[model samples]
Target: MELDDLIGIARARWRIIVAVFLSALALASAYVFLTPAQYKSTATVFLSINLDQNNLSSGSYALSQNVASYASLVTTDLVAKQVAADLPDLNLSPQALVGKLSSQVQQGTTFVDVSAQDHDPVKAQRIAQAAADEFRKEVQSLQTGLHAAATDAASLPIKPTSPKTTLDLLVAAIIGLLLGIAGAAIRDRLDKTIRTDKQVESATGAAVLAKVIHDSQASTKPLLTDIGEFASRAEAFRLLRTNLQFVDLDHPPRVFVVTSSVPAEGKTQTATNLAISMAKAGHRTLLVDGDLRRPTAAGLLGLDSSVGLTTVLTGQIDLSKAIQVHPESGLHLLAAGKRPPNPTEVLQTQATRDLIGALREAYDAVIIDAPPLLPVADPAVLASAADGAILVTRHGATTAAQLEVAAARLHSVGARIFGSVVNMVPRPDPGAYAYYMEYAPVANKQ
Candidate 1:
């Protein structure tokens, strides 16, 4: 893959990368600390010919020939047994002594090095010294006229040859980093959620009405227009309000039910903010809590829910008395009062339709906070009464399949869908949201 693609995958799944890397490093650390340390010791032997000055060159060639044979003999059972006899304290058999001993002749020279490796430094040194002594004796016993002499005796090693903590950790970390990156790339490829604007439009075949950036304070500050928190977020709602007006110029959608395929996708908040923005724009907007299953608009607006849509539907109170005006934003709130056991029947009634018609005539706009379409049919039913519906979906959380199903649900009931709103978008990448900056006026900076 390209560098940019790899970086994106890493950024998206950095947690997985960190987890895998730490796990690998921990295992490497355990191995480094638990494994026994090994020490290696070595002894050197030199082979030479005792010859006259006239035959010096020939004697050198003869020693060179004997060196190869002597080196090969060092690993023999005879030499190993002799080494065991030399190091009586070691109590090792010929086979065991040979396992720890290694012999190699220095190239272009009549010299050989015998090395031994073991967990104990003292044993390693003893083995190397005994193996070299045995090898030199064996060469003399061959009666080849070559004199074999010990050049240097084996000495105790101060440090170990294996269990290198730092080097092993470095190698392990590299492996872990590679594994983590690979896993992230695979996960991104397998992800089914629609994360980008192009994906949303491609899935629903509908223009995105608004892209609401994610805000941690959204729930605490539900009404952006309510508290004068006029920032880029507020401007997004205002732009949405303007775009809705332009959606159907001849017959603009004034009565809209904001909903999604599932709960907590920011539909209720969108509906609440949209109504407030409409009111801020000087439009007589009536925000109704149509979500009987989960009525939140009334509580968000701080309005009394003892007498509301239910009271009016039951003929216990007039629709005018059921409505409460927001003292801050001038937006009217009709809470889902006394949540009925059966919201489906309540919204399906002709009285509900009549109430919507009256509200549309009395007010410039009526935005209803309806229940999710997939869970209940209340949203679709309420949409049938309103001019159009606005679908709210959380970016990177809602799958393309869910959006398609939601759109189909509205279409099946013959309800007009004005457009879908992509909500809870990532706020970090302002570079990607340059288009929305045009609508974010200087007066709206938070």
Candidate 2:
């Protein structure tokens, strides 16, 4: 992906990144706060060699060159042992003391520096001075007559070199930021869900009929009556209604099985509202509760659920007795009826087909609210029987993989797969709905 695309993904998944980043920073801060403070000190010394009268060739320069080489050997066991003997408090062995001490020589000069680190500032200064003194004595002894007596002394450093809080925090912040961005990228790559219309169209090759704005205020009631109060929800259903009218239905899709990949995606509400809207347009509409396992249409509309589709299908009651008419809109409802044991089998029967055929002849539109496709085969069976199927998906809840699998499953069974409906679109921009709402005529009281 390009940098801009990656940035967009990061923006979408920013919560996960911030969560990981904050967690890492908190751990770093805790580590820094809990760690013990350590101090460091340095001691400087000048090296020189005695020049003979017979062979006087820049004795000071030669001493400086020799000292530069010898400075590297200062951290060896021999120098450390000599330094250890001089200090009673510094009880560290040569190997153990190597990490705490360092030495460096100035270029083209006879000066060498020996640095020591410890938790205590005073002890660090004392160790640096003592180590340089011991090294100087050892060098003079080893050189014998080649070097003069040591004229220069080592001086203790005034400042501590460790516990650099500012530098530590700066490094920690950089590490934390990298970790955050990496986490966000990983999460974005791993997720295969479809949250946008472009993704859905790219995956399914189906144009988005409408982007339904989710109404926080949308209830069981139809959108037409409350179009003025809940403008977004009313506008969404109206757009969907207009789009359906354009579909080239040979016999006009009287039976539409509205379902989703999973539950709680607003399929039942969409089917119910769609049916109500169709009925309001002077068509005799019948909303069937095909999900016998967990029927919700009758309860949602506050209608009598004494007898419904199941009762009519089982020959216990006729269609006229089973169908319940809504008090507000003239739309009729066929509740799932008493939760039958074998809902899938009931929906696939020839009797059910004949009943739907009869309803299609009698009504202008018949919308069947079926169960989720993934969980059960009830919707698939209903889809096969219905004229067409409208798949409903929630914006952030449903994944691209799930939607594809659902559509493929419906297609596999020869179910007429109509275009998808993106439901529960939260807080859509005014521009998105402005174009659709402009076409809707202003309401007038008769």
Candidate 3:
């Protein structure tokens, strides 16, 4: 993925990334705290070649080359083997000793430094001295005269070289952080869920008519008065209502099927509220509970749940008797009465069509709250009967893939998608009171 995509993923999954990183750091800290302190010692050794003074010029250059060659030999297996033999107490073989020992040659100089790391300072010092002694012996074996003449020796380190706790923790923390970011990015790429209006528009190629802000007030009252107090949500519904008017009234979409990709996305609530709002504006409206599987409109609106659309469609009851008028707003309510065995067949019958036609002639708008699109074919069948359908999606709950599939299903059946409504958007700012201020003037005007 590109850098921007990686950045977006990181931003979205910041919490997960942080959690992972902190967890890794916590583990590293625990390990460091529990680990025994380790000390290291380094010894310095000088390598040189014996040269005749009569040929001093060429001898110095040759001696310098020999010193460079001796540094390479210090890292050889032969040197490691000899060092292991010299330091028996350390109990390290050539293979095991390689990790503990390191050698470096100084530039423009004939000195080579040998370093060893271990848990104990004395062991570290002994290992460094042993490796240096072994290397020195190998160098002298090349020439007996040089072995007898050489006076340079290995020196003991004044201080321990390791257990750099601060550096280790810093490096561990950095590694942990990078790993966390990478994991977060991967998760974001794998997630195909819709969380915003931007995703809906991009996926479905449909206009987002309105984004309804979540109002706890709307949940408490049957009337719009409670929601009217929150101007933002009320205004959003008003805008939706106005947009609905723009659709040609001659071939008007009188019956609108409101459903979602899944349950609990406020489809029923939207239908109820939108119907009430239309009724309040002096338009005769009817809200039908088309979801025979799990009906909830009757309870939500405090209406009698004895008989509704299901009874009327099944030819068990008459349409007039099945419909009930709301006491507060005069909006009609039609609940899904007694679950039926063949809900899809009942909905697709001639009786259902006749009932819808009768409701259309009687009411200005008929808003049907149908089942989820993905789980059943009930909503698609209802949408085919209705003039159009509105897909209600809860922000951060519904996914892009689900909505796309739902739209495709609707299109396959020649169902017109009226528009999409993004529900449950959180309040934008904490301090802003403009919505409340607008409500005050409207309330006073009312």
Candidate number achieving the greatest TM-score relative to the actual structure: 2
lDDT of 2 at 118: 80
Native-to-model Cα distance after best TM-score fit, residue 123 in candidate 2, in Å: 3.3
User: Which prediction has more favorable lDDT, 1 or 2?
Assistant: 1
Total clashes for model 1: 0
Q: All candidates' lDDT scores?
A: 0.86, 0.77, 0.79
**TM match of model 1 to true structure:** 0.75
| Tens digits of per-residue lDDT for model 1, 1-446 | 89987887787678889999998999999999999998999999998888889998988987788677778887889998888878788788999877888888888898899899999999999889888888888888886567888998998999998998889999999999999888888888888787776777776667888988787777677778544444668868978998898888777777998999888798988999899999988999999999888798888888897778998999998888788999988999998889899999999999999999999899999999998988888999999888888999898788888888888889888888888888887775676456545544563565
When 1 and 3 are scored with lDDT, the better candidate is 1
- Which parts of model 3 have CA positions greater than 4 angstroms off? 1-4, 54-100, 120-142, 145-166, 169-174, 211-253, 262-266, 276-284, 313-320, 325-331, 394-401, 423-446
Error of 3 at 403 (Å): 2.9
Question: For candidate 3, lDDT tens digit of each residue in 135-250?
Answer: 77887888643431223333444444444567767877898789889888777767777756679887666778778877777667534645554567776777778888876668
Ranking by lDDT: 1, 3, 2
Better of 2 and 3 by lDDT: 3
Q: After best superposition, candidate 1 residue 230: deviation in angstroms?
A: 5.7
Q: What does the lDDT read for residue 296 in candidate 2?
A: 85
Selected candidate, larger TM-score, 1 vs 2: 2
Q: Per-residue lDDT tens digits of candidate 2, residues 261-371?
A: 999888888888888778877888999998888888887777977689888988998889888988777889998887788888888899999998999898888999999
The per-residue C-alpha lDDT of model 2 at residue 111 equals 71
Residue-level lDDT for 96 in candidate 1? 86
